[model samples]
Target: MMHNATYMGSVSSVSSSSIIIELAESMGSGIVIIEGKNYRIGQVGSFIKIPIGYNQLYGVTSESNESSTHDVEIIESRSRRWIRVELIGEMIGGEFDRGISEYPSIGDDAHIVVDRDLKQIFGQPTAGQFTIGKLSSSDGIDVSLDLDRLVTRHSAILGSTGSGKSTSTASIIRSIVTNNDDVRLPSARILLIDIHGEYESALGDIAKVFSVLPDSKNPLYIPYWCISPENLIDFLCGNISEAYKTLYLDKAIEEKKKAIKTNNIKDFPTESVTTSTPLPYRIKNIWHELYYDDTVTWKEKEHINAAYAKDGEGDAENLIPPKFLPPATSSNPPFKGGNNLVKRQLEQMKSRLLDSQYSFLLKPGPWTPDKDGKIEKDLDQLLADWLGHDQPITILDLSGMPSSRLSLLLGSILDILFESSIWGKNLKTGMRNRPLLVVLEEAHRYLSKKEDGLAKQMVQRIAKEGRKFGIGAMVVSQRPSEIDETILSQCGTIIALRINNATDRGIVKSAMSEGLAGIIDSLPVLRTGEAIIVGESAKLPTRCRISLLPPNKYPNSRDPAVTASWTQDRTPENYEALVSAWRNQEITKEEK
Candidate 1:
């Protein structure tokens, strides 16, 4: 017989997975001692063992009522005195396997799981086992997930602010890439999108950081020509009609044909090239030509020549508009036949080109092209800069970037990598051979359900088809409710932290499999760093406390110490420096 300490009650009733246990009246104590340790009775998310014949059925208590339960967020019910257990797996022939061949009889004995059973269930970490944390119910038990499935199938980390979402993310990633005597994965490729610039302090040691306003060895640059012309139109010419958009795209294709021939790209189908092809062309040159066409005047009824006021050729290099002769209202001669259809849009494009804040995208260093469509460097060099490093991780710090166009920029980055993956699938250097993990932090900023931005489209594409190309995405956000349902549903693993909002809780709950969502009720009250990990990567639905990252390795995401800042004595203000940093649109080296 098992230890008397393990006795909880007998199964009073049984359903397919949910079993109602009638608490043992003889054992009235709410806390029972087993092997010198006290285990709470019917604690939600704690494991329970039901013994029937030779199989030991293991289940997690989803709903349990106790008179003496007390916690930070209490959900105890006095009217309901029942313990509902959801069977998870079974132990047969000393091996743990999910599902059972036989069901537990109504009068079968239910035991509060002890250390021995937990150790059997969790097991020791082996190769491919990534330890996330200790089980919340049994701290001594380490909860590990299958690392292969996690990186291949995709995952999400979600929670409210200050709930330790970023910390847990940094910890899990660090655990994967951390070098030690036991393991050394120097080739592991993790690309983290640091939307708020919060991960550098946590992951800098193991990662190579790139930023638009760089304070490191790497300065981020995204070539404008690499952007899909449709996305470019959205950013440069907002609220444009479809007819103008088509014309704009056709112009880009024309420019691309010239670029492909001049750049001598090998085997490229210049004949079939569309606006989506990544071709290097001078954006200013295109803008100037388009504007000229819109505002040009004709000399005669034949529309031949010399309608320009005098030497009025605009400088495409300088974005100078030519002086044009006014169109005659009663046309015969000096008739300016220029349509002026896209004059406003061309001006807007020129303005964006002139803005210094967008220079990183417009006049990207090395990748920028001249009027002749020649560049100092090409996409190969740009990709090498991002991926060909000794470190296992690459952090794209997007803190100082324009949030208004974040979707287009992010989409361009993914498009570059995805297209490379597609074209290079047969090569040894492709993502299929080495694999890539893209971690999108603060994903809701661009992946909102309401917006149909390019970022969302590429993410959806990756979510649906990226696995075959060895590209995986991890969408981290505080608000799961606002994320697109299609993207959220495609995630195979969900690492949900404490979410206080009921609607957010519902989103997390719905993400879990129907059988496992029962324990998600405890989500709202989870302590910081505690999470319920479920799905393809998890061995079982486990309520685990995530391991704390090294103090120095925690993400720079802690709440401001308002009380301390208020209590401190006044210091000299530096509004001048503050204004300078704001105006320059950069986080300077000193501040970094």
Candidate 2:
């Protein structure tokens, strides 16, 4: 029993954590069977066990080379040559752990790791474990990840398009909150940033969907005042003078103070109030005042008589600019009032205000402030509508959003949640008490290194301090190379699916442990849905197939079958609905 059929080779050389094993010439079969199960020899990522006393050190086969050319199969040919192994972990007193307690000397016998050995290494399922999928080599065994480390340390899921990346993402989260085996985790909070609005049907049964173009009762509203005034000012007013900027912010603060007093918000920390505070202030009213101040004309030097058109004072609610009289050519009566001409900047701001595409931000329902900065409902209800729902997940669908503002809106959403967590750290409703997992789909769009958007800034903050605050980010993208290195490195666990692009594969390679180059090398040929999981969350580097979601549960990102569709009977050519959908930036039932 000491040297059973599992024995394969002997260590010929040792250098630190790396070792070279010389295959035994007696075993040229290239296959070993244990309990009627076949195990291939000299396969990369396969485990090799070395024993010294009661402790057993394990190493994974990383590379294999033959001494002479042969015509036989690659697996058979490599069985007669030496193989390189990277030291992974050890088993002592029936317990499996990472890192070796003792190094195996040269000439130590190394045996193939079998089913029982894998069980010792992976261990039985436990409360701290979350099963993502099963081991590829061994179907009966599961590959469970360390849930606490996976979340607290942050994680990334990367792969090329059509590699089952989105499906894998949906499946992974589904595993967490799925109620099975008498287990119930109703408090599991996962906030998915569905950039393309693809997750509504994927996780609808288990997730609450909030869309900018709400098809249901839950209308997604992000009041402009909820974001920092400094950021919002830039988007609202193109480029205002520093003096005008100050005046605008002052007006905002005044309105906020008035709101605090009028609403009678008790025990408020007024001293900490700044232009950055998330407080309600009517945007239309602010824009109206600024426009009038910049362009108003006075009939006299004392400004006793105002120059107004026959239309009276313009409606601020409708963004009607108060018609003003032109400045007098003779420098009398209507003069260019002492105010500076901010026509260019204010004009830009007015165009933004008038665009219907930005209604979610400009005229947020319920949270929108009246002319007096009084709101129909406060921020508390907005938070509850997003986080305090019956489902374990909340999907914010931003498919209807314009790409130009994607970064700003996404970043503002993150800022809101992260700030909430920071302020309510000790409270039961805070992120610390009930941790939140924020899943960012198509992360490269906003997190790219070349862009300096608000999304990048807020993501950097969350990546650095979120662990301590019980907030986790899962960045999902096809192009990992485009993501900022700082942000990518912060992710302790990386689930790399099949990557065909060399640059993308290289980026994924660099993000993983340097010792697993052999495993990373196998990326290009991996089957769709297969992934290599490594880093702090994984006790051992694992290559396994991600559990597949049901067809109905798949994300709405599937490519249309061109061949199958073309072969079908042609329907009446009616592009009216298509044009209308494109013009409206929406998917009508007919178009869908």
Q: Pick the candidate with the highest TM-score.
A: 2
Candidate 1, residues 1-592: lDDT per residue as tens digits? 4546688877866778777777776456678877789888877787889887788999888776633334201323323245778888899878888777788887888898898988988898778887878998788999998877887889999999988999999988987877332236889889999998899999898889998883446889999999988878879977777987887788788888888778888888888898878888777877776777778888787867848877788798889987688887785657876788778887888899988778879989888888788888889998888887888999998888889989989988999998988888778889999889999999999998997888899999989999999899999999999999999999999999899898988898888756556678788889999999887888778888988887688788889899998999998876888788788786765553
TM-score between model 2 and native: 0.94
Query: For model 2, how does the per-residue alpha-carbon lDDT over 255-371 read when each residue is reduced to its tens digit?
Result: 787777766777876666678777787777777888888888888878877798688578888888776788888857686763656877877888998776787888888888776
Compared with the true structure, all predictions reach lDDT values of: 0.83, 0.84
* For model 1, the run of ten residues with the poorest summed lDDT: 71-80
Q: Against the hidden reference, what TM-scores do the models get?
A: 0.93, 0.94
lDDT of 1: 0.83
User: In candidate 2, which residue ranges exceed 4 Å CA deviation?
Assistant: 66-80, 179-183, 269-271, 338-340, 590-592
Task: Give lDDT: candidate 1, residue 189.
Answer: 89
lDDT of 2 at 124: 72
lDDT of 1 at 163: 89
Cα distance off (Å), candidate 2, residue 339: 5.5
